[model samples]
Target: REHEPLITVEVAVQLTDAKKFFKVPRTFRVMVCPGATVATFREVVGQDLAPSGRVMVPRGKEAMMALQDSEELPDKVTVTEFKGKRQVYVKFTMAQCYKVLSLLRGHLEKAESQKALHEAAIEVAEDEMEYRLRLSQFLMTEAYPVVCRHFGLGCDGVESLRVIPAGMYLVDQHLELLELQLEVETLMKNRGTVNFLMGKINELRHKFGLPPADYPPHLLNFVYSQSLLS
Candidate 1:
């Protein structure tokens, strides 16, 4: 009869007294037969470590939790129980795991910082767009009609009287609106950059072995949902 193939699994070992021992947590890959007992797996992991007391594996979902709150794997449990899992967490004691966590935390921090900057830029862009829209509306709806009445041209002559001094103000306002529109277009194009940064933040979070972030409604929704000009 053919024998079952060996399964390769990653074992992440948490050092008990990392600070005192001046050592960091470590991970090792080991090959074990499908039906191998948990006891056998622990022995194999111990061979690569120092004389750090007992080697214990966390049970099921507890592997992702703090070591102190996690239950140890039973000696009679078969390695095949974890066949689908790529990595397992083990430790010498219930103490905290450092080193690897610290490195991942550093990466997460940087990603969060970059995301913040992108969010700030989006807010500024939205504010500037709103300001320009308000000014343009005021000039067209309120100021333009009042100027036409003062020049005794009424609404009909307003467009034909562009050469007059009063009409020049309307012309200048139109040019300003065009410039503002261009600036808004440039800012809207930056939405792609903001999306790229958000992707990086989520990627880093996953690498840190964290759950999805709970963003506020405004952030969770699309940054530019409505037309800026509208």
Candidate 2:
């Protein structure tokens, strides 16, 4: 109202009690009544030039409300903005301040819940990626040699392999050995091997506070023996 004394109110980033909220050089500034309650103050902060008044915000009607809700807002504080161009002021009765604080408390709890959920989701994704890498490494170091021995293929220093020997130089013997090697490679790459390794890796990963690894589909098609040859 025109009869009301307009006390300049400037909302600051430092006003947040904990966990610094706003990062940039920005704030909410408006002239509000010294007699206004927190509820009225909220309305003033959200009001734009709907009536085409001097209170023109940078964005629109909802700008201050959006900024206020995003962080822990200060209460009944007096400060200065732009040294003197904007004067920071707030005057709330104890009862009104308490009510606003209660509402903000509930909002903080909800914000914290949202933050925790987001962080948990990211942690799950990163842990799964690490699990896959570790599982692949285990297969190469532990399972590959076992597969090679079963197929009678000689692994050279855990590196390359000697081709299946054609004993007696018989073509049939050479083809049979080749077929056996291919079968061994297929089994090593089967989904069963992935499932087996997941079980082993989960035990170690979980011990280190990481989430358990799920049986991955991509791992089922990753041919370790063929990759080694390549």
Every candidate's lDDT: 0.37, 0.36
Number of clashes in every candidate structure? 0, 0
* Lowest summed lDDT window (length 10), candidate 1: 92-101
Q: Model 2: per-residue lDDT, tens digit, 1-230?
A: 01323354455432333443455534544434454444454443332212222221245544433233223233332221222222222332333333322332343345553354335435545354443454344344544454334323344232412121111122222333223333332333333444444454556565657776543444444523233111
Best by TM-score: 1
**Candidate 1 similarity to native, TM-score:** 0.22
**Please, what is the TM-score per model?**
0.22, 0.18
